[model samples]
Target: MKNNLKKNKEISKEQIKNYFTKSVSNFRNNFIIISLSILKNFRTYVYVILIPIAFLMIYSWYTNAYKGDFKPPELFKYMVIPSFAIIFLVNTTVSEWKNSVFLKRIHSAGISRINFFVSLYIFNFLLGIASFLISVTVMSIISLIYFKPSNGTFFSLLGLLEFNDWVGMLYSLFLCISISVSIGVIISGLINSIALSQSITLIFVLFSIVFSDCFLPIDLLSLSKPLTYMSYFVPHKHSVWVGLISASSQEVSWAFENPERPGRIISFGFNLWIPCVTAFLYSTLLLVSGYFSFGWNTKK
Candidate 1:
């Protein structure tokens, strides 16, 4: 009996080790497949990336031409970065869903749904970061040559910022991308039609742009009580505010408060810990939802 028990324990341990080993190998293979697939269609990425760079350049030119007090490049970074990430991620994910042959091939090769979902998520997140970095680099060059920040303040892209400020900007940017990528996955799983998915994604992007507190503060808008309350659910508001505030060297002129809804307020000054925490929590919730929503039946 003792010998049999010992043998059973050894077998269990071996099985556990093999399970983990196979899972890791599968994950690596899935990641490679996802990377190759995404990179193979690099043209789409190039076009998508160029749109924002062009917009930033033109906006910077206009702001410089008009001598606006706000820095166009820095201000737009919050919206542009997340918008690019969302559009690219959602489109690619939906396209992947539309590719039935590819999904079947991977599944037949022993790639589990979880592995595919996670691999796609990581690859898309990294790609999103790369695209944003490229955009920022180009915008920094434009800012240096054609655009000057108001009052000789430092540029957000390539400026001599303090360590904390850099941390704040990076955190905000990554938070935005994380949230965008997760939501993209969830949307792709929910909407199998590529065109429909892209259309809804575009609508989402437009909504975020119009109401993200970038063009104008949400608190200032004379929205109805329910609409005003719903506006708080928009994750972009917190991320954009954090990024813009961190990037700015001068005092924020607007009062970050809602007169009607006193509870909805981004407190004055650089005390950004709360907003960061809030954004992080929201992203976490989205990620959990994405995990459950991803890997659904594409046929449906």
Candidate 2:
């Protein structure tokens, strides 16, 4: 009996190890397949992402130059970075689910749904980072050549060049992209039509931007109780505020409350860690929800 129990234990251990090994192997194979597909149609993806960003950057530059106000960092944080990120992630997510034939082929090949979902998430996230790097690099070059400092303040360009500020910008970018990709995945899973999914994602992002403190101050939230509650849910508000504050040299508090001066309300300062944690939490929730929401049926 003792010998039999020991043998069973050994068998169980081996089975566990084999399960893990198979999972890793499956993930690696799926990743390669996804990567190759992305490469084959790389131009389609690149054009979809780049055009809007280029347009936005050009508009930003023109407006800034006309007004004699060129702040690369603000332009990046406000418009360019998020434009590329949303376009790339949303389009990628929709494309993955739009074709029924592709889904059936993938399913028939014995690729597990979990593996497919993970591969899609990772691919989109990496694409987001790539788009961000490209956009920032291009914008940096433009700034150095075109932007002139009138008052010896190059906060935007400096933020990109400085080590600490650069890291903070990257950190904020990661969180922002993670949130966007997760939301895209969720939208894709829920909406069957590619057009609908893309539209919804765009609208959602636009709505978030409209409500974000970047456009409307959080203090105004007090005017409407419902708006105040809704403000708590907009991740863009947190993301933009965090990105701006992180890049700024000024000492900014994250907390909105002021104990010493109750009348003096702070909008952006709420402890730097709060947005970071909230973004992660929101992404995880969206990912889990998207995975569960994705239909397993391949037949259309």
Candidate 3:
């Protein structure tokens, strides 16, 4: 009897190990397949790399000519990074929703929902990173040649501590991108009509651009107490703050007031932890909702 019990335990252990191994393998295969499929789209690379670079160049020129500063402008980061992340990712995810053939293949192959969602997220994240590198390189070259920056170092425009600051900035950018990606996935899962998807995407874009406090300060917009507190719900608000904190390489102080815009209270400090925790929670919640809600309900 003891021998039989030991044998049963060993079999259970083996079965659990095999189950995990198969799951890992399946996930890896899904990732590789998704990566290869996305890589085949040359236009994706061009659009992702060029559009932002073009915008950056034009904005850099304006800043250099008018502002007389070649340093990376705050407005550019605020406008571009969030815009790129949302537009690119939302469209990508929506396209997947539109692809009936792909959906059928995934279902027939028995691909798990987690694997599908994660594969999409990771691919988009890596693509965002690629776009970032290309944009930075192009901007760096332009600054080196045309801008004649006063700092004498292109990296300085990104903020202090050179390498460390860049990492922080990238982390903040990735956090923003991650949140955007989650939003995209959730939108794709929930919406079935392409027209509706486009409409919603437009609304998201408009909000991120205008109301995200990108053009005007949130302080100016928030007249009521509820409106003031509600600004925290905007993802872009936190994204911008985190990027600014990372770039400044200075500790955030809530008491510090902007000299240019007086009467407005500062909303700095806890920059790192605030965005990190917020991103994690936002992504987790959205991804969970997306997974449960995903379906082949798109209009043909």
| Tens-place lDDT digits, model 3, residues 1-300 | 999999999999999999899888888888887777767776566556766676667656644533444334353363335335445555555556455677667767887777777777777777777777776777567656664445554555554346665666666677667766667766776677666776786687657644454444334554444554566777666665566555555443321234245444444334566765665566567657766766644643
Give each model's clash number.
0, 6, 0
What lDDT score is found at residue 200 in candidate 3?
84
Q: Order of all candidates by lDDT, from best down to worst?
A: 1, 3, 2
* TM-score ranking of the models: 1, 3, 2
TM of each candidate vs. truth: 0.80, 0.78, 0.80
Off by over 4 Å in 1: 1-5, 61-66, 70-83, 149-160, 215-229, 248-271
lDDT of 1 by residue, 12-99 (tens): 9999999999999998988897777767776546644766676566656644633644343245453344344455555555466455
Give the per-residue lDDT digits (tens) of candidate 2, residues 121-207: 787678777766566566555555556656233344453445765566567777677777777766776667777767777787767
Q: What clash pairs does model 2 have? A: 253-269, 254-269, 254-270, 254-271, 255-269, 255-270
Over all chains combined, what TM-score does candidate 2 have?
0.78
- Candidate 3 — which pairs collide? none
What C-alpha lDDT values do all the predictions have? 0.64, 0.60, 0.61
Residue 66 displacement in candidate 2 (angstroms): 6.7
For model 3, where is the 10-residue window of minimal lDDT?
251-260
Query: After superposition, which runs of candidate 2 have C-alpha atoms over 4 Å from their true positions?
Result: 42-44, 47-49, 62-84, 87-98, 150-156, 159-167, 213-229, 250-265, 268-270, 297-300
Candidate 1 structure, TM-score to reference: 0.80
